[model samples]
Target: MSLLQVSGLTRRFGGLVAVDGVEFNVAEGEIVGLLGPNGSGKTTVLNLLSGALAPDGGSIRFGEHAIHGLAAHRIARLGLARTFQLVRPLGSMDCRDNVIAGLAFGAERRWGSAAQREADDLLARVGLEGRGHAMPGELTYIDQKRLELARALALRPRLLLLDEWLAGLNPTELLEGIKLVQSLRQQGMAILLVEHVMDAIRSLCDRCLVMSAGKRIAIGLPGDVLSDPDVVRAYLGDDHA
Candidate 1:
């Protein structure tokens, strides 16, 4: 069975149907990309899967358990953790503290010491070596994002959801972020990424899914999906395709 499964998932925001019966499966250790233009329901899908918003219809299964209506904390405890588009580092804490908070709080097997050590290692891996004591305001934007990735890893999540983790970074930061995420996949983590940056998605994602007007329009290999006429027209216009 797929490690993460969503069948006929739907979510409505009053007059708008943000996610319209989207169904997909993510297997263990796979890196899947969720791509779409603004208001295409990519982030909405991540939010629903991560329990920040409950689904209006259908179901989600992480492993063998039903998770559609579980509370955020409850879902996290079930081996799922997520990173947000906007980094939410504790304003008053240092980088290490922010990551430590994730280890202590997110759903996962208890391993305080191991989690802290793992967090530190992850920081180093993401090129933030020895800057763990710096606060969010003190670090550069890239470092702040690196801390966010470390924080999520502290949960040792089986399925990790990342929403635009590279949105604001420059070219150099974007490259590093891709490497970080790809490295996570190598560590046997199943990842769901909602990304606007096509270059990153093309390079890091094993498979790509496109959404438009709150519905999935295409899903396939990155190269095939990127070149699809429908996907191109949705965001890049016909001439670009």
Candidate 2:
């Protein structure tokens, strides 16, 4: 069975339909890409899935449970975790403590020294090994992103949702991020990635779902989907048409 199944998922704001009847699935140990241009509803889909926003319609099934309409915290406890397009770390807390909070209260609910050890391991996994004592404001942009990933992993989620996690990285950092994602997949965690970096998408995704104007325009292998005429038109305007 799929780790996550979303069907006819939708959301609206005033007169704008942010996500329209979107549908897709992510299986265990697989990385699925959600590709689209800006305003194409990609992040909205993540929001709905992670319970950051309630859907106006459709179903989200994680395992056997229907997750749409559930409270964010309730949904999180069911083994689903996500990182924001804009990293939001607790600035006042040190890196380790921020992750420790997730370990203590997330799906696993691990606490005390045990949670601290796990948080340390996660920080190391994300390449923030010895920086646990540093404050969020003190770290560089890339380190902050890694901290976000570590916090999400502390949930011990069955499915991980990533939103543009590779947006602002240098070449070396980008390569490191990609490798980290691959390692997570090797460890059997399902990932739904929303990324603008085609190189990362091409490398990490087993299959991709492409969206435009709040609707699916293409779905297939990364190479094929990226080459699709519709996708090209969406990303690069069809002014000649």
Candidate 3:
């Protein structure tokens, strides 16, 4: 059975339909890629699923619970966590404290020394070991992304939504990110990843869903979806395809 189920999901801003009748699912221990060119509504889908935006129609089920219009905090408490395309860390706080806050307020609500220890462990897991004392501004761009991942993990979510988390990484950092994602899957966390990095998609996703103009255009294995003529035309110009 699917860990998450989304059907007929739709959203709009004024007259623009950002996400239109989209559908997909994620199974436990699976990583599903949501791929599309810019303005294809990938991030908007994430926003709707994470409760940052309420859908105008359709349904989203996490396990047996209906999560369509719930507030973001409530959705988060239900073991759904996400990282933004633009990383947002508590700038004034040190890396460790930022993670600690997630532990203290997240799904489990762990607190005190226990939360601190778990935060440290998460930092190490994300390759931010021994950098816990540094402020967010003091970290490199990739390290900040790591910190954001650490914070999301502190929520102990069953399903994670990642939006463009691999966008600006160098080759080495990208490889590390791919390994980290694989490790999460091994640990039984399901993921819905929105990424422009084709290599990352090929390396990490178990299956992929392709979107164009707010609609789902294809769903299949990564290699097959990327090879689809429709996908090529949507990404590259028609002439190039």
Candidate 4:
């Protein structure tokens, strides 16, 4: 069944349409890729789904309830959580504390000592086993990204939105990142990720939704959509296609 259903989703900034009547669905335990070049409104769609930005038109149904204009926290409590393109852990909080915040505020509403224990476990799961005491500023870029994943997972969400969570990494780190995402998929987590790493998308996404100029250009199996002439033109220009 679908965990997220978005129809006629539209968002605008003044006269500029950032996301134009985009529609898609994420099924339970399925990983879907939102693909496009820069400024295709991918992140805007994520923001709207996670309730960071309200859509001017369209409806978002999470599970059975409409959530188009709900507050971000409310959406989190409704089993939807997201990580930003740029990691946004609490600057003043340690790694463990950052995750604790999510557990406390998320769907299950964990708190106190229980939340701390679970936060540390989450940190460990994301390959940050002994780094919970460190501040976000102390982590390397990839470690910080792992922390971001841990924070989102602490929400115990049914559907997770990841915006470029695998953007920058060396070869080895990229491999590890792919493995980490694979582990999440193994655990039956449904994910909608916006990523530019084609290899990662190919390995992780069961389906892809392509966008261009705020419109969905293609939607299908990764191999098919990525090979579509329109998708090729959008990424590499007409010359490469």
In candidate 4, clashing pairs total 0
Clash list (residue pairs), candidate 4? none
TM-score of each: 0.93, 0.97, 0.98, 0.98
At residue 9, give the lDDT of candidate 3.
Answer: 99
RMSD of each: 1.9, 1.1, 0.8, 0.8
Order of models, best TM-score first: 3, 4, 2, 1
Model 1: how far residue 128 lies from native, Å: 1.9
On residues 1-241, what C-alpha lDDT tens digit does candidate 4 reach at each position? Answer: 9989999999999999999999999999999999999999999999999999999999999998999999999999999989999999898999999999888888778888899899999999999998889999999999999999999999998898999999999889999999998888788889999999999999999999999999999999999999999999999999988
What would the per-residue lDDT of candidate 2 be over residues 155-211, giving only the tens digit for each residue?
888899999999899999999999999999999999999999988998999999999
User: Tens-digit lDDT track for model 3 on 1-241?
Assistant: 7999999999999999989999889999899999999999999999999999999999999998999999999999999999999999999899999999889878679888888889999999999999889999999999999999999999999999999999999999999999999999999999999999999999999999999999999999999999999999999979867
Higher-TM-score candidate of 2 and 3 = 3
Give candidate 4's root-mean-square deviation (CA, Å): 0.8
Ranking by lDDT: 3, 4, 2, 1
